[model samples]
Target: MTRHETFARPTIADKDFVLATDLDGTFLGGTEESRRKFYSWIEESRDRVGLIFVTGRDPGHVRDLTRRRGVPRPDYVVGDVGTTIAEVDDEHFLAPIAPLEAEIAAAWNDAGMRVQAALRSVPGLTLQSSGFRFRVSYDMDPDRFDDRAFDIVAELGLDALVSADRYFDVLPKGVSKGPSLLRLLTHLGVDNRKVLVAGDTLNDLSMLTMGLPAVAVGNSEPALISALEGMEHVHRAREEGVGGIAEAILHHKLLQ
Candidate 1:
């Protein structure tokens, strides 16, 4: 064992706890002090807390961050906007979510080529490099993007969601962060109540609306905030990024 593993790990009664959070304006958006504190807490309580990164980034980008950035390695990574799920430890991604991927594949077609071909004539729809087996992403001018895009997606049997005003994603009919996360929790045998989801953008709306306790940062997109209105389980934090996450953790008494 390494010297770090030689020490006794911090113990908590709630071993079932899972923190599922989005990146960008949520996990990586806080002040330096708050980020340090949050990272420190995760390091200190590594054994007790299960950390999951629910992000829109591809697995390669996620891997880069895990290797280069100071972010604490997550136990599980739900990447590609939750279409991809992998069990990761400190060094590498070890397990594949085969069943989950298969389910998504059943709904998706042609790696999104069909959707792309359908939308090829649509102006202002620039394809993003984030295309994967379950998702096809794009950057588009919402003003130029008319209902035609929606019709194309629907006709192709896909679901389209726009976030942060520019990111357009075409996903499988039932493949979204909420349902995918629920599936992951079921696979892990973890209760939904034990999991806390956090995010700050419209892309995270589905996960936030999953009826699990959630945290929306102060810097979250206005649309996301509006959508979360009247949702009793979500806590709007005064702080941004990791600070908001910390606030929500305390607000829900999740560690207890």
Candidate 2:
């Protein structure tokens, strides 16, 4: 076995622990080797390192992405920016944690009317329930939008969160990845100290800043890098995308 493999795979009681990573641009970049290594790591470290995917993609899309890429399903999935949390069981997403559904329902209804009206003004834009928020996107851009959309959201007193590229995620005030991660932590009886997070996008900011040992997967955006650089526990990955993930996994000795 390679030295890297020796270091990457460790026993659970050897202080091996869990990792919560963002999926899209971090680990799976729609590449063959990337997908191969990702699944390899997951399968190798399955017993010791609990791989949890904390992504902004909705559950359905996450399922499709995993199936298409041939990656092992995550032990836990924090989808739609923490709108819904679920566990995977052999092609099925089971054991949902719907704690926020009631709150989400109330929050959505409160902002739906105004948000819908504002979204309608943007051509090619349609709204989808993302579990925790409403997502507005255009067909041509899918994520692209002019400055006017943000302005309208501001005027309507709604929160507009941009995940990646040009996509718009509108969440209620105070809903974010940090709290969602906390909820999961509590449910699993895992302390924050035992968690390690890695991400590479705007939506990952909250969990990254939650003071866990977080690594920004790559150069990321200058603004995001700057915002997170000062955190004593945060580290930057040596490589971009999944390479960074591998680096962090090795550097931290997260798996035993």
Candidate 1: tens digits of C-alpha lDDT, residues 101-163: 787877775657777788889887899865476888988887887768988888888898888
Model 2, 1-256: lDDT tens digits are 8666655543322335777888777766425776687678778767666767888777777778667856667777877776666776676464676664556545555676667777786754556544334433233254345667778877765567775555567665555677677677777667566678888877889999988878888746666687787787778876777777777777766554
Point out where model 1 deviates above 4 Å. Answer: 1-16
Q: What lDDT does model 1 reach? A: 0.83
Give the lDDT of residue 162 in candidate 2. Answer: 70
Q: What Cα-based lDDT does every candidate model obtain?
A: 0.83, 0.69
Which candidate gets the maximum TM-score versus the true structure? 1
C-alpha TM-score for every candidate: 0.91, 0.79
